[model samples]
Target: MSSFRRHTCVAFTAAVLVIAHSAAPAMADDIPGKIAEASGILNDALDFSQPPVLPTIEAPRKTDIRASIDRGVAFLLADQNANGSWGSATRTKGLNIFAPVPGAHHAFRTATTSLCISALIELESGGLCQDVAAVAESIDKSEAWLTEHLPNLRRATSDAIYNVWGHGYSIQALVRMHGRHQADAAKQEQIVTLIKSQFDMLTRFESVDGGWGYYDFRYGGNQPTSSSISFVNGALLVAMAEARDIGVEPPKRVVDRAIAALRRQQKPDFSYLYGEYLQYQPMRGINRPGGSLGRTQCCNTALRYWGDLSITDNVAKNWLYRLYVRNGWLDIGRKRPIPHESWMQVAGYFYYFGHYYAALSMDQLPAADRAPYQSMLAKLMLDRQEADGSWWDYPLYDYHQPYGTGFALMTLKRCLPD
Candidate 1:
């Protein structure tokens, strides 16, 4: 192992020992059992089995990627609601995920709209879109809708904190909006104000454990008692960093606590527990490598962006390689309707979300190191586009296609040759 990887392992082992030593004392008779259990958990947490050899991937033609992006943009243009938002609570399935009334749908629409707007902004900025006029119009309409509704967004119920996703994603969109209108000082100021509001919302909804979680089943109080979920923290921190790049600093207390929470859940191999609640059950399928395939990318990127030196270029490349080689683990769960029903408890929605973050993680590497992974990601996305010109991995009311396409578009844009 490299020196950094060795240091990470030693540091994590020491932290675990400190926690154990600080715990309440046990009787002599109980010592053996406790030791055995701790040993088991530690062993599970340190599983570092070598991944299968990397497979060769061919780069797709740039023209092919351009065509795919054009189709995706066209789909978004045709799918926008009359109100200029992207998703609604329509298209119910018999086994739909629980979404409580107007609030959940409100969060969903805001998040979906924000993603669509970000995608359009990225393509327009890169000069990748064939229909620039139409794309600009869609972005303007959606940006107006988001600015109008985002401040009112909140937890759907005390138990449902899905709005955190909306808040995180909206912050990203607002950052893009801030840049897209840089020449318009008035519009940029308005976007800056909106970005600050999102930071406030994240602070308001941060889990008591430190980061954020989608569910608060523990106490359902005003201040959530949810366990900090690893990937949610990854998404939120990344967005906050983007806002910071544009002169909008997030609350330091919130950022520090979130980084701490995420670090606690990370194992020696860098596979994270699904949530802090799963800390003891580190050997569970969902917490293992195959299960962590989608999460490691985002979590690593978030930490790297926040100045975690251990997340080196090699670490980033290793995870990106795993994402491509073992992608079937995630693909099997795609469009299955039920979350975590597939092997390793992999969920369908993680498909595009994972690749999207994988693309972000790829950006952390040297420009010379990004080409192979870019080609690999582009091919994966291109192969999955639906005949309707959109991409979806799960059935999330009417929201899936829009959010999926939005993620896919941004991801593909990253794949374009620099």
Candidate 2:
């Protein structure tokens, strides 16, 4: 094992971090899926969550699926630039912030970190990435930084608003590391301590009914909306997944309460109904509009139990047909008070939730129905990549694009290998 991959089984959730030169685990057989050949599969199609690319390819033959995925891998390798990013090396686009401790004004910005990480996890699972070096380097540095700094989380951020995104980044990095056998026992315990602190901090900041606002608990100022709720939900799910991975799961009641709270907040359309006086449905990127930007992930994660697949599936199906698909592909509403591009940030829920569960629901769908999703997903990655190797940051909610960029990168890395 590489030095970074040195943690043993006792280290608890240790993920291997094979530096570029280290020997790789035997590459798994090629993943079965559609290659990057098609582009217009869903550009004009309607009434579906994604373009029917991979699933359609899956029905005819498993061999074809494997081949398509291999071709896609080649495309990814071909796309990489020397600077490590798949595209340009420009400073990521971001909001400018004046930090108290900096010689330079901290540029407030991030691309879609969440999507990026999501995608990378898939590649790690598939073992097909061609240009893994650049990302591997980023992960190594980030992991070292995370391990050294996880225990210091409370110092960097205190509330959900300030630290929620940061916390999400920390969670994804840990999740990746633990899988590689890097997060040893001490690291796991430190994470546990940080989580306890974060949960308490959230509860303290939340309102009476258990919702949140811009800075902390919701009040007369700005109130909790679906988009913000989704970000928080992502953080909690990360917590739950990590806790379970480390053998220190949160109380069943705590998770249950959070879900129940989410269910109570849902409207007839399945979108979240939030705000103090005004209420509206969550849209693609609408931040604090009359309605909020609630998506399927909230419903999906909120409904999961230790072994309750039925409940989660039911929730996902209901929301997919009603709230999500019914809304046609527009941003679905006007811009709000926050400073954001609206749809760009929030619409990402479609790729992550749509694919994550779609994969789960794969065994159930007809071949034709699923292909478009795969095609659409691949197209989305190509369309969204900034020349600088990151995604555009979510406008209002995500001031720091790197975290969101991380999420986006993760997501793309999962769904599309090349």
Please name the candidate that would achieve the greatest TM-score relative to the true structure: 1
Please give the lDDT score for candidate 2.
Answer: 0.38
Worst 10 residues of 2 by lDDT: 102-111
- TM-score per prediction, in order, is 0.88, 0.55
- Which lDDT tens digits does candidate 1 get at residues 29-77? 3356554223212223333343223445678999999999999999999
Worst 10 residues of 1 by lDDT: 1-10
Give lDDT per model, in order.
0.85, 0.38
* Cα distance off (Å), candidate 2, residue 411: 2.6
Q: Evaluated with lDDT, which candidate comes out highest?
A: 1
Error of 2 at 139 (Å): 1.7
Could you tally the backbone clashes for each prediction?
Answer: 0, 71
C-alpha RMSD (angstroms) for model 2:
15.3
